[model samples]
Target: MKNKIGILALLLLSQVCFSQLLTRKLIHGQVVNDSINVENVVVFNANSKTGTVTSSQGFFSINVRENDTLVFSGLQFKSKKYVYSDIKGIDLKIKLEIFTHQLSEVVVSNKNNIKPIQGSQSIVDKKYFDDEKSSSKNRTMMQVGGVENPMDFVRMYKDVFKILKKKYPKKTDFTTQTDFTEIVMKKIGYSFFTNKLKLNDDAIKLFLVYCENESKARMFSKSTTEFELMDFLIVKNMEFKKITAINK
Candidate 1:
């Protein structure tokens, strides 16, 4: 009877241990904000002493257990703390307020404005048309109405080209593939791909790369609204699932 009781006690202890292990799983979370860039925000788990920085899309995953405290801090945002109660779902959405700096009042004065010296005589140097003529002779062919000559016409065109180049320079797109992907992911969230679209992490990444191949995806970076981008993603996601045969 004592051996039987000991075996039952061991089983109960193992069950509790297993439950604790299940509670200590990786929790997916996001630092959500409309006005600020949520990337690089630090999320510190006080209990475990482990932390993770938010992605460009403001998403982060951290190992959390029951009753663990998560602290979120960033340069631009106010620090916030959240306790893991398991009351909320596995996915945590933390909204942080922007930190505003209070500035002291500044005063400007023009009280000591400079005044011209009293009774100062102004001197002027007189110049004749000879100086103007000498200066005119040093002027370039384009400035001297020499455009009628073929060589002068070439010089004139070169000058015009330089001006045009300065006025309207070629625009270079510094936006990289990673940057574009982040922008799309930020506008449309990770949950959209994971939950609604039923895409696994690897499949979601591949689907994004597939979408990036589309010409319309580049346009989504610019003036396209979130709704428009979501619509585009939905269509592409269907095509992606069809091609990859990813039912989930």
Candidate 2:
């Protein structure tokens, strides 16, 4: 009987521990403007793991365990984060505070001085350009490893521009784009497995999401413009740009 009692206590303790274990989720809530809900607001945990976006009804949810912190954000509203303990259940009524970022003196100066470089418009990296052409590195990257110039690189960029221009006609400006004429180039590094690349899809997706959000903010938002998207792809590929010195 004593052994049976001990076993029961142990089982009960195990159940209690299980119940207390931390879990993550999507917490749902709404942002109302004149009694109408807004959608696509971001809600994420401090660790950036648990996250979700508001629906058309202005409701969002992210799963989180006890003591986790959640951030609520959107393009027009100031971001706010709160601890799980501060709110109970998924339903929440949040009042968004309007935010207008005042540029610091340094920022103002930099903005004025830093003319938009052609490639700086988007986050295009070399890999994205390569992947668009089936992940084959061409002259700039392949040439360094004693490999033949892969023509696919040019094809990839060409195809990317073609598609982007069709998708976003007004914003795309591939005509003024500079072709990467090979100077002295070298491989900074190589990866046998694509996942080994630090700035992979996971990182890029976040940028894409940000771009989407930024586009919706105003009558004319720049983030998701064709020029920007293509630029992002180019910038992403440039990570793999073989070190090259042009004899200009």
Candidate 3:
């Protein structure tokens, strides 16, 4: 009886040590919409060796091995990736972003001669950030434009283009943020256009990726890991620049 009790105590101690040991990590992040917390967004481990979804409170806890890569995915949102070393615990906030999808037609129209729109482009300004200011995790300022909702911007741009076409009634090449600014600037003799912008697969693909990153960052921020990501655009890089000036 004494031997059995001693063995049981050792087993219990071993279990406690295993749970407390940080051999693996618990990955977590909150999924919120507008200001309200959204629950039950699916989160999967990207490494494929292990994976799990979030809980009802927009939080998820997944056990990850050392050096494992984590991938968080959801509906109508971009998927985000992170490393095991980057996530500390299961307390973090994630903000999801939406994508825009528009189809332009190529047909003969007597009213106006608008060219067919082809290809998708994304312009990411190569930003140089200034000195960092110390702030709380929740107090950090997020650009309302990028974080608020991108779908609205897409609609507003589309409407403006429609108005411009109606007013000019010409086949002027329609250019906006939809095209690479570097390509446009190269034609216009501006070298600052060397900023990083690439033709993403499509708007949905881009938005999904953005949302995933944003959400992952939110959760990753709560972790003890340190990140070397670029600073927010609004901090020091927020400014309106022309993508292209259409010709009549």
Candidate 4:
């Protein structure tokens, strides 16, 4: 009995040491950008939920582990993510792309051929002015007429509601959160969870629940692209695997 107890204690000690070795460690990293202002750029480790900000020189340090996802976000730069794996050295260098805004095309045209009016004289035709005034008055009269009957107002409301419902279905109406999750699962396919992530059926369901609780994964159903959803799943998978290993 004494020998068996000693072996069990040794096994437990080894497991504890192994778990500690797998834990995250502080890593020094730098953000590379072409622009001069790199200050205050957020460097976040999604796995650990810890973050740091870059200095004026774009240097930052944060805790990270193998397969950890580091997200860089800032006002002036497009958001970027880096997975830490097979890194040889202690320092990491990540590059950021500057954000650019493209304005919609605007056309400046003198279609009316109307010059600036001199004193009381007008350059445009009097008939044109009269036509514009008559159209504006007609629109005002139509609005002022309003709905004649209470039933007519209700019918108009129902018609508008139907149009909105067809365009954008409410979550409580036809789809619940579970429905959204299932839709996403179908879109991504079962093979991805099993083949790429190496997750069993039960584990996949559990992982989805974990993501929903931790990262609000259901919110992705709103406006996320396939690429964006895949990126999120990849990062969440790394974190999920880390948590599972720790629990073991």
Candidate 5:
């Protein structure tokens, strides 16, 4: 009976200790002027792995301790972070402002009666334009060697920041989608493409056009490995042949 009593007492003591572990405080936040409780507001603790989403009533419960930073993100507003100590209460009333994007208007004219491309008002395939091409900054971040051209290095740095911003929260994406396609073309010069794929000048240009149209052009960056990029291009070459054959 004594042994049983002692074991029971120890177990009860352990339970009490476990329950007394880090104090849990409720952090309440509201989106001001939001008639409906904004649903799916992401609450993330940048300091730790603690995260949660707000409810339809614009209410969320998260287990947080003191000194934990909470970053709130939503589609309708700019992402904001609140440090637990910065605000002394469990409840936080937040106002989310809509983010605006300024874009130049594009007018499309069909003088050549080209097929209208999907996703944009362009009468012709938008791929010919450098900015219209899909680009990936992941390749830029993966670059290992040094860049001799100062301008290229600057562009690469810009791309890296754009990548980091897009990766977190994923609200935006970064593309080296300016006139940089020329830089890419110069990097993967005719000699490089000819030696790798054994293609003539005309064929290579056509291949480039195909890559742009297919949105596969971004894979060829200075940081891309020769073997991998070549493999991708070769496969795409075969697919391009099949496509051209069908069109003819």
Candidate 6:
């Protein structure tokens, strides 16, 4: 009985050690490539079943463990994954590559094996071909599209999006936050003041007004982690409440 109890305690200790394999890494991730900051990019980890989307500034943070697979998915770009072991650090930047699809046209000549449907009559699906954009995953189209001229296929695939832009108009207005002060304010959201800091409405209004003064705004920004930022706010929470007699 004494031996069994000792073994059980050892097993329990081992279980605890195994559970502590990963430290909750404070990650500041940016979704971008060499040129653009890709907002709305989905950052997911299948192993942990956890995920987050990039903010308008293309920023995100989540606790991830070692060996976790971080999948970066978005509508405009190809979905890519990076193992957490490969991304274990403060400088977490994910660069995304654009996706293009390839397709081929096969015209069957009744007599011979194949030829370009005789003269300039064109294929049967004229309108369809004009509007059709193939997907990269369409193996059937790729098989039919021919065993391929990759460069031509990529060029033609790109033209599909251009045609789409003409057919439908979308707002492309993009502006980055140039003012460092404004960038700081956006990082610490309004909810943090009410919920985390527990500041009253009147005090919150005054603090927001105070942030515009430059010195106070220095505490918040993209570089600051959420926990560290919250700590700073907690200090401010005490200071501001005291100065206004609200703490009394």
Q: Which stretches of candidate 1 lie over 4 Å from their true place?
A: 1-10, 17-23, 103-248
TM-score of each: 0.38, 0.38, 0.30, 0.40, 0.34, 0.35
Write one digit per residue (lDDT tens) for candidate 4, span 1-248: 99999999999999988886688777787888875657666666777776666677888877777888887766567668788874546698888898888889986886877567565334322334446655545545555555633355665787798999999976563233444456567568788888988999766765665555444565665445677767788888887676545323
Q: Give the winner by lDDT.
A: 1
User: Please, what are the lDDT tens digits per residue for candidate 2 over residues 1-248?
Assistant: 99999999999999977786644554556775654356656665565443555666776555566688676666556567677753577666777776657766653363544555567524343443346566654545535555444466866887899998898868544333321111001112223113333445433333233333332222222223444434543443343221110100
Ranking by lDDT: 1, 4, 6, 5, 2, 3
lDDT for residue 64 in candidate 6, whole number 0-100:
77
Top TM-score prediction, candidate number:
4
lDDT of 5 by residue, 162-221 (tens): 898878855322245432245446445567677866677755655554454333566455
- How many residue pairs clash in all the candidates, one count each? 0, 29, 2, 0, 0, 1
Question: Which consecutive 10 residues in model 5 have the weakest lDDT in total?
Answer: 171-180
lDDT of 6 by residue, 1-248 (tens): 99999999999999987886755565777888766667766566567655666677878876677787777766567668788763357558788887667668765566854556654334532333232455434546536655553355665676797999889988542233333335435667877777977877655655443333324454454555667756666765564454334112
For model 6, name the residue pairs that clash. Answer: 104-145
lDDT string, candidate 3, 38-144, tens digits: 54345545554444444556666666665677665555554566665544545656666544476696656686655444542222312345445654234376555
Candidates 3 and 5 compared by lDDT, better number = 5
Candidate 4 Cα misplacement greater than 4 A, ranges: 1-21, 104-248
Number of the candidate with higher lDDT, 2 or 6: 6
- The 10 consecutive residues of candidate 1 with the worst lDDT sum are 119-128
Clashes of 2: 29
On a 0 to 1 TM-score scale, where does candidate 6 land against the true structure? 0.35
lDDT of 4: 0.69
lDDT of 1 at 37: 73
